[model samples]
Each structure stands twice: as structure tokens, then as C-alpha cells.
Target: MDAHPDPSAPAKPSPDPLAVIRSRGYLRILLLAGLIGVPVSIAAYGFLALVDWLQEYLFTELPGVLGFADVPLWWPFPLLALSGLLVGLCIQRLPGTSGHPPSEGFKAGGFPQPRELPGVVLAALATLALGAVLGPEAPLIALGGGLGALAIRLIKKDSPPSAVAVVASAGSFAAVSTLLGSPLLGAFLLMEASGLAGAMLGVGLLPGLLASGIGSLVFVGLDSWTGLGTFSLALPDLPSFSTPTAAMFLWALGIGFACPLLAWGIRALARIVRPYVHAHRLLVTPVLGLAIAGLAVLFAQVTGENTGEVLFSGQSALPSLINDGASWPLGAVGLLILCKALAYGLSLSAFRGGPVFPAMFVGAALGIAASHLPGMALVPAVGVGIGAMCVSMLRLPLTSVLLATVLLSSDAYAVMPLVIVAVVVAHVITGRLPEPPGRRLSGALPSASPSTV
Candidate 1:
């Protein structure tokens, strides 16, 4: 009886310790990807630096030389609209290159084919120079990712899916590293965007993070060696902090509540313009471009400020918006926010660029508006506004905080608490925002699919 095995107690099978990963082919692909990523990251970093120079010296300076009352409000509008058209055409016409960063959202891995890089570069530079509501950082990631994937394909006859993802991540890390002003932000962006889980997190994340670290180093080295300067959304003269006050915390709380409203406004405008952009694709796009130009003219005329206030890049204007204006009336501040927010929403929908800078501009404007209220300091208010807006737009809490801190030179410590409070408030407020009507799932309507990449 004892020798007879019970029917329910048969011999147990041994577990293969390596069974989890050994069966999957992704590990080999990941290794190959890391091997190819190092140089690609370096190249991407170098390219961004060059583009940075062009944005400042070429785009900013060109109009001054042309001299149409400082190139007039209409100048960049047409050039940028044409750029959006080209980018749209490129996305529609090019196989494996059908989308850019803005359309793609925050998905982790991306690599555009080499053929698409030229279009990506031209569109991004043109869009930026033309004063589109978009940001350059988004395009930079696409360019980097696409070029990196292209490199992998060339070097290897066939690459594993894992390797492709790793390279793309590395390329992205490099491309936007300088814009973040810290490789850590780049890494955080990737990590938060990836949606990776469990063991898969370690598979290629390390290599991708390594690439970003090296890329930032390369960016710093080149900036030092060439004295070309590292490109950042920062003003060198941003005054240092005194100690943060309780009022600054209140500013964060207020910014937190206000951020959702701004976010909704931006998205709503984008939705409104998207159909128009799509319907008129080739013909109507240019008209929309002219409209933006008209709006710019109106913005300058109504506000009685330089057309530059409402025009291209807006990077230079960020610090000014944050810096308190004793002469700026409350009415002017409100008008600035409304105009910039509207322009930002329209520009985001029809134009090609990133959302980061526009968000900063919005926040800065909001800060200016709030500063007019009693008991608010300019720097802390600006920091709260920027951080809150970023949280709403990107939904990246850590990234928003870093962005806030990096901008303040002396008062970073004081600003830190406010940034945290603002980010948390912004994040919570963002959740309260209702998803767009078209975004809801229903059998009767079009599918709103969720994507991992």
C-alpha cells in the first residue's frame, strides 16, 4: 500500500530556473540593441545642440536682419504653417514614418526610419522658427528615435524586437536630454512613459538610462569644448530664491486648481481645430496659417506689446512673463493668458512642435495673472504655475518638479516645496478633468483604442 503512489500525488516536475526568460527571444535582441545604442545616443545629442544654435542665432536673428518692423507678426506664421503641411504630408506619405511625437503621446519606444529624419528635421526647425505653439523637445525625440532605429536596421540584417525598442529609447534619451537640462529628467520621462512592468523593466531600461546619462555628458562636453552653450528652456539671470513663504504654498494650491482649466482649454481648442486641419488638409492648412498670423497681429495690437510677445518659440518670453511687471495692469495679464492659451491650443492642433514650452508659457502667464492678487511673490508663483501646467499636460509629476526647480537659481530650495505641492495638486486636478466626448468607449461610436507605444 505504501509503495503504491496515490493517484493525486504523482511525481512533481522540476522547475527550470531560467525558464521565464530563456524561452523568450527578447533578451538576445536587447543585448544587440544596447551594443548599437551608444554611438546613436551621442549623435542625437550632437544634433540637438546644432538645432539649438539655429533656433537662437539663425531663427531669432534672421528676422531682425530682414527688418520688416522686426519681421512683422505675419512672418513666422506662413513659414510655420507650411512646415505643418510638410510634416503632415511626410506622416501621410512616408511608410513607417506616419506619425510624429505629438500624435504619439508619451509611449516609451519610437524609431522613425532614416528617410523620415530629413522631413522630421525640416518640419521641426521650420515649425519652431515660424513660432508654432508647439515645443522642440517632442520633435527631437522623434528624430532621435527614428534615426536610431534606422541605424540598427543598417548595422544588423535583422534585429530582435527587444533590441529595436532599446535603441529607440536610447535615441530618444539623447535627443531630448539637453532640453530637459538634466539626463535624469530624460530617464524619468522614459521610465514614466514606458508602462513597463516586473522583470521587463530591467531588460532594457538600464541600457536606455545609460545612454541618456552618456548623452547628457556628451552634451555638456560639447557645450564646453565648442563654447556653443547647452540649449535649455532656462534664463541665466533668473533671480535666486530667498526663503519660500506660506503664500507660495497657497500659490501652488491655486495653480493646482487652475491648471486643469487651462489643460481643458488647450485640449478643447485642439479638438476644435483638428477637424478643420483634416478637412482642408492641403488647401485649408495655409489659410489656418494666415489666421494664426492675423491672431498674432491682433495679439500685439490689442496688448500694445511687441509682436514678439505672441510670436515664435516663446522661450525668450518665458522669463519675462515670470518676472514681475510693476507696470502690467491686471487686465493686460488676463488678456495675455487668454491670447497665449488660445494660440497654444490652435498651434498644437495644426502645427508641428512639442507641448512643453507652450505649457511653460501658459504657466508663466498664469503666474503673472495671479501675482496681481495680494500676497504673491513673482518667482514662487511662476514656479507653481509652470509645475502645475506641466503636470496637467504631461501627467509626469517628477518631471514637472524638476522643471520648476531647475528654473530658479538661488531660490531652488524655497521653490521645491511649492513645486511638489503644485505638482500633486495639478495631478489630482487633472484626474478630475472629463475625458473628451470622442474619447469615451461605445459600440455606436468610433473606437478609442489605448496603445502601449
Candidate 2:
């Protein structure tokens, strides 16, 4: 008889895509994920607290001790110059070159080696506390990954490289969950950056979700216990928003079109500054810091708002920009955008922190100013601008949308359609834009290139 007779028999089923994950070892990984979260969350919290304390002491308390009621317009000049020197020393002398360059933007590099953690922490602390226009996310990611790898090596020396990577990613998920105010959002950000997909996505996400959930709880408990409030992103008391109209859609398109150009400009400026930074870091970095300080002074003198609005990563100042948009004149808002954008570019080229928050702040300022147009409302304008800018800068549309909308509380759902449109348009346009020219110099600073350990 022909073998074709076997067709009558039951067909063999295809194996489940997740069969490998369903194996016995996965449960162990899951348990380890939960355990890793506890210490990672605590470490993340400590890092944020230390940065906060340092910022206050260096910028505020020190000024008071010197007999000034508040930081003077000239204060940041010297302060930032000193910060640059210290940061430069850390990067040049320390291993891991004090983590990756901000110019490369946010990337999900795998776990850092054990020895690299100190450099990452010290560099980030210096940059953030000294008022660099950068965020804390990048350093936290590096720290979490480093710690995770170290833990794995100590506990299971023979663990496969793949297992180490999974645990490291889980550790990162825990580290950032609290900062973003949502474990889900943090997971999405990391997942997108890592390019995880399909069966692998599900497999990877399970442990990460476990770690992030526990981490968020740890953040809550710590916040409650210490009364210091969580370092998570929050925007309280947002103004109500109306349903998006044709006029708002039109404005969204305009913002979508404009933001890519802004992103390109920032990238180009950073590329241009990189060579100079590499050639004369100690000099160029300090000069860039002074330039940032000068911009702050100019913004303050012109807008009469506190210079603090223009300095640092712009995380704490974002709420004021949104809530106080109506009170700020169009001219003042415009000046703030100009100053912050320039400062942001300078910081990216020379500093050692993430680029997310400063970009958001600049975009928020742009949106608030655009609200002055007849059709645009404050809430929609703010949401659209942020989404568009973030997508352009970070190239992660989902994370950008969540970040822009979630801050609006209940208004998030209402404006989400508009935010989506803006983000899509910006992301597409950004992709079509030409890449920045390659650096002429070879074998430059370790952080200058995008490669991660």
C-alpha cells in the first residue's frame, strides 16, 4: 500500500511557540525575576534620592550658604563649569567611560559588566545633579542591568549567557517601573527599544512584568514610609479638554511636520559638537556648560521666569509649563523653547544622561505656545506637541503616546486620537529624514558611539 494511506491518520500538531519557555527552568527564572526586583527597585530609589539631594545642596543650599537668597543669574556659569570638569574627569578616567553618550539616545544595551557600574553611577550623578539638560533613565537602566548580571554571576556562575540577558532585562524593568509611574509603560518602553517580538516577546515579557509589578509596589511603600513622595512621573490637576476638532487635527499635522525638522537639527548639532568634545573634552565640555548657563540667564532676563525652568532635565518643571501655560505670554514661551532646545543639544553632546525629558519639555513649550492660535486648546496642543517631539527624538511611537497622554489623567483617552496622529506623522517624517553624517574621527571616546556592552 502507498504511504499516502497515513493521511487518514490524525495529523501531528505543530509545537507550541512557547514550548521552550514552558520548560521547567522558566519557573525558576520567574522566581528570580521577582527576587531581583526587590533590590533593583531599592537601588533605583536610592539613586534618585541621591541626585535630588545633590541638586539641592549644590544649586540651592550652597548658594544660601554663600549669602545669596537664591541662585544668581551668574551662579550656573561657575557651577556648570565645575560640573563639566568633574564629569570629564569621570569619563576619561573611569572604566565604561561613565556609560554611553547621550548623543546615541536611549537604547536597551544588555547588562553592563560589574566594574562598569561605578562609572555609570558617578557620571550620571555628576551630570544630573549639576543641571545637565538630561534625564536619569539611561543611568538607571545601566545600573539595573549591571547589578542583575553581577547577581546572576554570583548565584549561578554557570548560567548560560541567554539566562543572564533575560534576568538583566527583568532587572531593568524593575528599575524604571517606578520612575515612569507605570510598570506597564516602563515594560513597553524597554520592550520596544529591545526590539523583542512574537513568541519571544511573550516569553520575555512575563518575567519582566513580574519584576516591574513588584518594583512599583516597592516604590509605593518607600514613598509612603519616607514621606518623600515617589520619583515617578505625575501631572496633577490638568485642565479639561474638549473633543478634537478639524482645527486641532490641522494643528496636529503642522506640529507633526515641524517636529521632525527640530529633531534633525538637534541631531545634527550634536554630531557637529561631538568631534570638538572628543578633541578637547576638558575645555569644550566646560564651555558647553557655560553656554547652557548663559542660555538660562538669557531666558530668565527675557521671560522674567525663574532660570530653573530652562536648566536641568526639565522633569519637575514640565508640570508648571502645562498648568501655567495660560499665564505665560507667547513671547516668553517662544524664548523658553529656543533656550531649552539649544541647552538640550549642548547637553546631549557633552553630558552623560538620557535625552527623553528635555525633549518633552521643549515640545511642551512649543505646544503651549502654539495654543495661542485661534483653534488650538492648551491640553490638545500640549499632548500633540509632546507626542510628536518624543516620537521624533526617541523613535518609539507607543511609548511616546503613553507618555504624552498618561500625564493628562482622564483627559488622556479623549486626546489620544490626536496624539496618535501626531506621533505617526512625526515618526514617518523622521524616518524619511537623512541620517546625520558619520564622525570623521575614529576610536573616539567609548560613549561617543552607539555600541553597548
Candidate 3:
């Protein structure tokens, strides 16, 4: 046969990957996704549990046991310093460099290599448990994806790469679905972040959706069985927000304008500090941690609020912040915003964890502060702030809007219009803003593009 023989022959069209949906192998893939969801969800639950317990013991209970009537102002300094040392060591010594850098912004895909799981686990534990201003969702996603990919390799040594990617995404979906308080929210997040859309979006996300649905049951079952609740995000008992006013729309536009500037500052600070972190992981990391601790201490001293409010990811504190916003002095709320933003930026530079909750927290703080202004209600202001800030940072408008509205389910519909406006505005502004100089972490994948995966 001549090498050029095919040039003269009629060209055959390539097989459609979507056609797999009609094949029996697709059933196997779905079954595998469901099966993998079980283990991944269990592991995710356990990881969250450990992190929660450690956070309580270290930040809350340990202070009482140490004979301090209240947590001392200096508590986080040493703890965060230790966290930096451990995280630095993990990055320098471990195989995977401890997962992706948060400074790169939120990434949707890129399953971690199995060998890197330990570094991801240990670094995230140190970052989260010891009061770094980041969330656990990123680690959960990476760990789940890695585990799912590993499982497929063992189950079918000859599995195609496409099937492995689908299953890996399924595992990620199962891992964070309930944590966001809904499988659909997780689906939206990954879908938007992964840039899935059109018919291809359905094809790519089907397996993940099934995995997350099954995984939600696991989360609920475990919560009921063990009396340890699913660590889901939610906001309850807000004052009623029934209608959107002209003033509310105005505030949404203003917030949409403001959030991008704040988001830009945070990322700029992280990028400026990141080069130093890379140059001296051991020394600079802990110094940055100490600086974060100093900011928390300053906020506590000024506001008479607990240092914990500024120390960790803002998940546990977010509800209380909003519910009690009216009771807070405007000056205190402003101080909190300043302190948390600084601490969050510092964490992003050198720590290893997700950026979602801290950004949400900052947004909520801004909203609560803004509500003190004329014509701004607590619920709608909070929704607008959350949507704007989230989109500004995450650059996923759909996920940001859902997060803002869904968490406030009682007022979801009422706030949807404003949230949509804020999300779109922030998304556009963030896109037009210049990005910081790029600095990829050692052994980390390149940052994700906005284009389709």
C-alpha cells in the first residue's frame, strides 16, 4: 500500500464522540461514575470532618483548655506560622507541589496526579485547619478527581483517555456537590468553570450529574447516620426581601462597579507577594502567615470581634455576619472587610486551599456594610454583593449568580434580577481588567483558559 493512496480516495468523516451516548460503553461509564461517587463522597466527608474538628479544637476549644478565658489575641500567630512551615515543606519536598496555586484563580479541571494526593492533603490540612483564609472545596475536588481517575485505571487498564476524563470530572462533582448545599450548584460551578455549553455541555456533564445526584444521597445518609451534618453552604432566617426597587437596582449597579476594583486589588497583592513565596518558601511563607495573623489581631482589637472571624475561610462566620449585620457598627464592618481582604490575599500567595468561601465572605461583608446606606435592604444588598464579588474573582457568572441567589433561597427569586445584573457587570469588568504577571507553581498545571475545555 502506498502512503499517498488515501489522498485519491474519498475521505471518511471522523466518528462522533457524542455517539458514545448511544453505546453500551456509555452505560458502563455512568455505572463507574456512580460507583466512584460513593467512595469519593465518603472520603470527602471524612476529610471535611477532620478539618472541621481540627479547626474547632485549635481555634476554639484549645484556648479554653490552655487556661485562657478567651482565645488570646496572639493565638493565630504561632498556629499560622506553623501552618506556613508545614505547607512550605510540603511544596518543597512533596511530589505534586501540593496541588494548584490559589493565586491562579479558580480552575475547573486538571485532575491531580495520584502521586500528588498526599501533598494536596497535607498542605490543605495545614492551610485550612490552622486558620488560613481559604476553603476546602478545591482540595476536595482535586482529591476526588485523582481518586476517581486512579480507580478507573485499576478497574480497566485499557480505558480510553476520554472516559477517564469524564469519570474524573464525575468524581469532582460528587466531592463538592453537597458541600455547596446542592448537586445542581456543584454542576453549575463545574459546568461554568469548565466552559461546558450547548449539546457538548450535555454530553460532557451527564456522567458528572449522575455521579453528583448519587453522591448527594451519600451526604444526606452520612449526615443522618452519624449526626455529623453535611458541611453545606447556606444562609437562613434573613429578613424578608420580596420586591426589587429602583434604588436596589441602582445599588446593584454601583456594587457591580465596586467589586471588580476590590477583586483586582486582592489578586494584585497575591501576585506581588507570590514571587517572594516561590523564592523563599520556608522563610517568606511564615512571615506572610504572621502578617495575616497581625491583621486578624488588629481587626479583633478594633472591632472587639473574635479573631476567628478574620482568620479562616468565612463559611461558618458568613451566616452570623449577615444575620447580625444590622447590629454591627459600620466602622467595625469596614474594618472587617479590610482585615479579611488582607489576610485572604496573604493566604492566596503562599497557602494551599480554594478561594471560593473567602471571596464570598468578603462580598457578604461588603453587602452588609452597604445595607447601612439609604435604600439598600439586607437581603438584596447581600445577594448583589455576593454575585458581583464572586463573578469578579471566579469569572464564572452563572455560578456566581446561582451562589448568590441559591444560598438565600427564601429570597432567591426576589434577588435574581439584581444578582444577574451584578454578575454580568462584574464578569465583563473582570475580563477587561489586566491580569497580573503569571507565575505557575512548581509541578502545577498551566492555569485554565476561559475557552471551552
Q: What is the TM-score of each candidate against the true structure?
A: 0.81, 0.94, 0.94
State the TM-score for model 3: 0.94
| 326-393: candidate 3 lDDT, tens digit per residue | 68899999999999999998899999999999999999999999898799998999999999999998
Give Cα distance to truth, residue 218, candidate 1, Å: 2.2
Which residue window of length 10 is worst by lDDT in model 1?
444-453
Cα lDDT tens digits, model 2, 201-283, are: 78878888899999999989998999877898877888888688999999999999999999888877888898899888989
lDDT of 1 by residue, 1-453 (tens): 599778998679744435634655545544544554456556665665655666565446777877644545556565656766775665455443333435223355555556656656666666676556677776677776776677777777587655666777777776666666677776777677666556566655665666666666766777778786666556556655677777767767988998978887777767666665665666655656666666667767777776556655566677666654425887777777777777777776656667777888888778767766677777787788888988888787887888877767677788889889989988998988886432311132112212112
User: Where is model 3 poorest over a 10-residue stretch in terms of lDDT?
Assistant: 444-453
Top candidate (lDDT) = 3
Per-prediction CA RMSD (Å): 6.1, 4.9, 3.5
Tell me the spans in candidate 3 whose CA falls farther than 4 Å from its real position: 1-18, 437-453
Q: Residue 120: error of model 3 in Å?
A: 0.6
Better of 1 and 3 by TM-score: 3
TM-score of 2: 0.94
RMSD of 3: 3.5
Candidate 2 residue runs with Cα over 4 Å from true position: 1-17, 437-443, 447-453
